[model samples]
Target: MRTVPKSYYKHFSNSEQIDFQKQSSLITLPQPRAHPFVPKDHPFFVRTDLTAHEMGPPKTVRTISQEAFDEVVKENMEDLGMEPTEALQDAIQTLSLQGVDLSGIVKCVPGESSLKDNPLIQSLERLKQLDLNSKDKFSDEDLNEMMGLFDKLIELCGGNEGSVNAAVATKNGGVELVCSICYKMRCGSKRVLDSCLKTMALLVHDVQSTETFRTGGGPKLLVNILIDGNEDPEILNSGFAVVAASATGNEVVKESYMELKIDELILEILSRQRNDSIQSLYDAIRVLLTPDDDQVVASQVYGYARRFAKIGIARALVHSLHAGLSSPSLISASIALKAVAVNDEICKSVAENGGIDALLRCIDDSGLQGNKTVARICCSLLSKLAGSDSNKSAIIENGGMDKLIVVSARFSDDASVLQEVMSIITVLSLRSPENAARAMEAGSGDLAIQAMLKFPNAQQLQRSSCFMIRNLVARNPENSFCSVMVSRNLSDRQRRTTKSARMQPLMH
Candidate 1:
């Protein structure tokens, strides 16, 4: 019972019209809406009278979240028949249009058939082929791919602390990778070179890989980058970070770094007007001073510290500590000073370089905020410097004792810090009778006695406490510490304390 328009069948013959009607009947059409108006772009389309300005201000665009962006990218990539790396690149561009900063997306990962054919290693090889000046240099996709490869390699080794075989890194052309990065650095591509430096930072994390990196002239290249890119904070920061990662607890790498005179370069950087480079530089210096349990390594670390002293590490540390009392640099510099102080000659050198004044300042400033770590390291460095009689005089002249005694009392409940405080008092007491008298005036004898009674089982504390008392009594009996000990009825055995001295009843 359908009625056709009069013009529809006018152009067709009878047989053709019947065939067309049959075909039209098989085709499905959308049901027409029951509306007073027509749909736009329909065969019978209509226009509205309203103008575009009748609407309010334009809609605010929302940012695309990373997950949603990744999904969209994945779909588009599949539709376009693109690979993972290419898809990532396209995704970066898409995200950029949405005003997202994709600089950090370059951290990358993956699997394999062969080493070269392995997706992660293959990504690294492909990244190397990229021109330094190419638009791809800043591509988030490339950064992600390279970093992703590093993550997978770390996984393959098990974790950051996991050992990657040098043979494996070599076979996979990691040596060449370092060389290529070095070449890019020399090419003066600051933007591209930053990405390269970050890669080197991630690669030299493992023990064997670090050795391979060192053998591949990685340290030299890093130093060169640091030296050449001296004004570039990003490059310098990354370079120092690489040094820290590569040298941490790696003795062979430490020796290699020492030979490069990296200590001198670090000192030079520290001596400059550099606020941004402080953290990285301190971190590098800390790792460089890592105390090794291996005798051979320990000696090498000691020797390197002497060189550090020669290059004015103490002065640099003092400057950094002065800049920020609560900063990590303060703690690191203090620790480095303590390590270097193990050598008596270095102790005198530090004192000559105003180390005592620096330590006193850090102690006083850090104590205001009750920063026990900084205070503890400061006290420890002071105690180590006080190993030399001349340094002890320097400490006293710099108002070191007042700060030490106050900090000792403030942190008395902390056994380790108290032990260091007492050790300094012990060394100071040995310097002269005036120091012994000053100790008594500061209640050094009472603090030592209280420490011995509180930490009866802490042999180091007990020994340091006993030594302080013995020095006080032996050096200045008229100073009242002698009568105080006599009244307490402390035994001769208790009075005579060395590091190896055994504990006995004090009231006998």
Candidate 2:
């Protein structure tokens, strides 16, 4: 090659020099040798050139393809004997720390136990264990962070009943964490307490946890929060929700209302007269005064029922009934008002507050008849209210008899509603000639007799219907109700009454 320059030969190995000369068009330098063990065009070394502005930046770790990354993660997880879920969680935590793109990774849906073990929840657990005695030992930022973590945990759990119970179990005793939070809430700044109360409301979801809250003195803690934080609607509403949740199904918790003075708190919320608080106040009142299956709690509820009326809860409920007659809360309120109307004085109060008209409207609501609970509750309250002559006249004057007859026929298939409607009509017909006249005028006597024939097997309905028909006949002997009963042989004792001892009360 005309004795190729040594400068060209300097860069080439002897093996590369022969091949370079054979492949070249002119006398060319040999290409630099690449190791045979490594690929000549591998990207790892191919794109290594850096521009001037990037010279100071540290080299990044090699980015792996997503398939390789997943395979590596799966292998590591398998090697460690970890569940795929845990591996994903670990990956998410790690990638989040490194600020990596997570677009393709599957997110974790934590279970009850997994949620309890979350880092944020663990931090809250530690915060709850902190020595309140230490006072200023913890900075305000630390406390705020603790409460904020609890809020985050609650939001993450999303009020799932299982997650709620799991969180409660993680704290010791059902409500230790809730009680601790409420205690902190009472003293926290408005914003802090409001957030804390929100967490409390979420935690008090089920009956067991709610009872634990009541026994743990959660109600007392919340009452103080409401009393002091009434100006803050968030705190007020959240605190009320917690109390309502706690008292919802647990009669024992309801019994604590008087001791906690929750009635006054409800009235306080009501006294603000804010429309937002109306539902909260009604919920609290309903839980406090609604009868439970437990007789002791029912008696206590009965005793406190009049107190709610005296404090204008009865009137507010009636007003709410008029405002949202089709609302479920009003349905609940009407049932609660039944408990209140058990007290004769409170029944009079219900009428005085325009409750009779409202109640009749509720009974007459075409949409309300489908909800058996609403129909039965409305009828029960009307029956109790109709015990008084004034309320009886008010009911009749407000088309009460017509409403009862319509509900009876509409829900004729519902034994409970039919029985209640027949009972109220019975109460109106008993020893009241004008009510009897109105019942006849409105064709309630025919409905009652129809209910009798329709539900001959429902002993309560049969007894109520018979009593109502007999009263209709006694009030107006010439009325066709007597002729109908006689015609159907419903007047026969064997067919009209049941032999069950449970039906004896109705027989009398």
Candidate 3:
């Protein structure tokens, strides 16, 4: 009874194994569970159904509200006993350090006297508060206040802080406000209009403000001002200043002004003997005609330069170079002439208008007065004009070679002036062996030798002298002989100097 059979035990074991398999099939394994506290969109949450590369929720950007900024500034003002402006600046700096986005926040403090803390803001606020549409005429007080505000704006937008202040003024609608004020006062007050134009000149120095000026019809306003204020020297000066400032490096503004026939206006204005605005007018012309690195804009500017020549701007510039013109005006006119002499036709136009003779006279006078700057610019313009065969002939016929030789001798110590003189000689002797012979005879070879010997470290001057020598000797055998002799002498002197340097070390 105690001994059970092994087969009976084996059958029980098989039955138990089959029962265990059925139970395991009927039962389900528990599914993986996520933490209860973790949200579905949390970065830590992993879903098996989704790919691993799914992006997480977007980050929140830190920002400060106007009220929050103002409260902080107020706290700084009360607790730290800081001035309102100081406290405001400190608050901006602190929040900025914390990576707070301060865009759209009013930069000024709140209060009836809020703007009084900042003159720039105060000026802008006062200008915006003016009701130009409501009144056809402004009293002396209103005009005076407006003038003061404009002057303040001008002061703020000039000098080392010009870029920053101009940006701030543009952001505060200073450009549009001034343009509107100018429109209302264009036909009203000369004094106010002049101040407004001057202010606009500085305001448009900012890039965004220039765009605002152009889109807001500032160019048209400026042209009208020039036409109506043609008789007023102050208005013309300020208006031309605005043109110069706005047209600089801005092709669209230049095209806009050109479309309005500003060239004609400038020519007409230039015809007058208004000495005060001559510099500004020339500056405006220079800026308008000057080309940048952009090929499309440069081509358009070349067209404008041609148009200026057609409209007698070259003659006008030549006229400005008359004997009695101020040195400043003379220099400005020469610079403007260089900008206008863009091509052969315009260069010939400049030459045909006595540009050569005028420039020669300027060189003589600058030499007599020891004015190297004037001479340098005159030589530069002469070189530009000399690019054309016809103009080069005109220059040589006008005693240009003798004038340059005399200038070089006079300012031999001035490497800058000599470089310019050498440049002109280089251009004059470009392809003409006859001109090269003439330059050699006129002491140009000696000038180059002297320049190279004197300014050994003057890289540009040395290079220019080399070019001059090459041009002078490239076509003429006689000139080449003289240049070789000069080079031999220069080499001998350099050898002697080196010998002295080595001997000095030995002596020591």
Candidate 4:
């Protein structure tokens, strides 16, 4: 259960004047344009009363102790960030779920002053009558009903753990009830699209699913709410859930949101830091990957990874990969490393800003397993970055030689990993074969390169020896690698000739 700050419930529950929602769930204009209202709240409006339970048994109840109530109220006032009196109103409304609305219980006492006890409810019921007499004012009862739904949601998530699941079940099963309620507020008007939102707003704040609000099309309404802007924090928070839910869907789910330009919202979520941690970024990616739309995918990746990639974001991801290289806990570290790998741009940006050195440090410091794999990837990256002779030479001087050897020697288990190490070395050698011969002489021989060579190996790395030989030939034609092979064969021939000459003497 995500515990909301008390003020979140407090101020949100009470202080909203009846007029705040009074404007006739009415749409500003009608028909030629589609009604903007997203839910069918009332029978007259959208007819969506799915979440509204038929006033059933209090499926669960608990009389909140005074201290518990005090803590809740304190949290409301302090944590929820509302004034105490306003907080009290919020508390009464929230506590109504446990069948402990202070006013309701106090008034239950025989002969208690009806005036002081249950004043808010009594006032609302009375204001409703006055509106009947006073001609065409907002019916306060509507505001009261809205408040009732809000209270139910608070209790649903806030209630005892056993009951919490039941509330979630009801919400997931019959969420449209809120739409029906809003429809009633809209008064059957054709132009009343925005009016549908009052109903949606409740669901956004109230609904929690078996898995999450993101599953199903629940996020669509939340997206709808965000596009409207001018929403309260509660509304925006629900919108956050919508983005989060998008991660769980298939093509249909993604299709439903394509019309919404979900990319902008994603950008807003990421760049705005709504989901900031590594785990949060993981979820953000998970949702983004679900949408096959390239524009949306790129936009979200651009949204978070790009904005911070230039900053320290890449470092954190690389740090994990480096740390994981030596870590015994392969599962967790590998998972994190994969997340960092999601965006190739992560690697590019890291290179531009000295990510290689940072990565090298990780290899140097790694305790064991994490070290070799990390070194291998780093070598792989350096090779890719070495786009030209200059780049290859730059990496060679920037410690690629030593790093590649470490990677080649240590991460000998995976053929693919080894191939990458070879590829990096090949690129370096290609820049200057003298460098290749130096590497080959240092221990990584033709045999080592042969071990990694395969049809699946990256094609660029297949000829490290070729590049070195070519350079060696240029370095000294008389002692070129090919010529040297010829010289060694000539020496053996001479030895055989000497043996023949001695045999001829013996025969004579």
| Best TM-score among the predictions, by candidate number | 3
RMSD of each predicted structure: 21.4, 21.9, 18.8, 23.4
Model 3 pairs in collision = none
What are the TM-scores, per candidate, against the unseen true structure? 0.61, 0.61, 0.74, 0.35
| Candidate 2 Cα deviation (angstroms), residue 69 | 40
lDDT of 4 by residue, 197-251 (tens): 3323323332233123335445465455555542233344444443444434334
Better of 1 and 2 by lDDT: 1
If ranked by lDDT, best first, what sequence of candidates would result? Answer: 3, 1, 2, 4
Sort the candidates on TM-score, descending order.
3, 1, 2, 4
- Candidate 2 vs candidate 3: the lDDT winner is 3
TM-score of 1: 0.61
Sequence-dependent TM-score of model 2: 0.61
Error of model 1, residue 68, in angstroms = 42
lDDT of 1 by residue, 74-186 (tens): 54345544455555555555344323444312212111122355444555566555534343233556545555555554454334433333234444565567556466546
Instruction: Give the poorly placed runs of model 4, Cα more than 4 Å off.
Output: 1-277, 280-349, 366-384, 387-394, 429-438, 446-508
**Model 2 stretches with alpha carbons more than 4 Å out:** 1-174, 187-195, 198-216, 247-256, 276-278, 290-299, 324-329, 365-377, 407-417, 449-467, 470-476, 479-508
Cα error of candidate 4 at position 279, Å: 2.8
- Candidate 2's residue-wise lDDT over 1-508, tens digit each? 1222333322345655555444332322223237443333321121223343433333222222334445534543554444566555644543332223443222333232343455544655665665354353445776677666766756654544446334434343325764665575466566666666666666666665676787777777777777887777767777777777777777778777687777776666665654544356556666776665353523567767767777777776676677645464666567656666765677777898888887777777743537667778778878888887778778877877888877877787888988888788777877776777777887775676566666667777776766776666564655644545445655467343422211212222
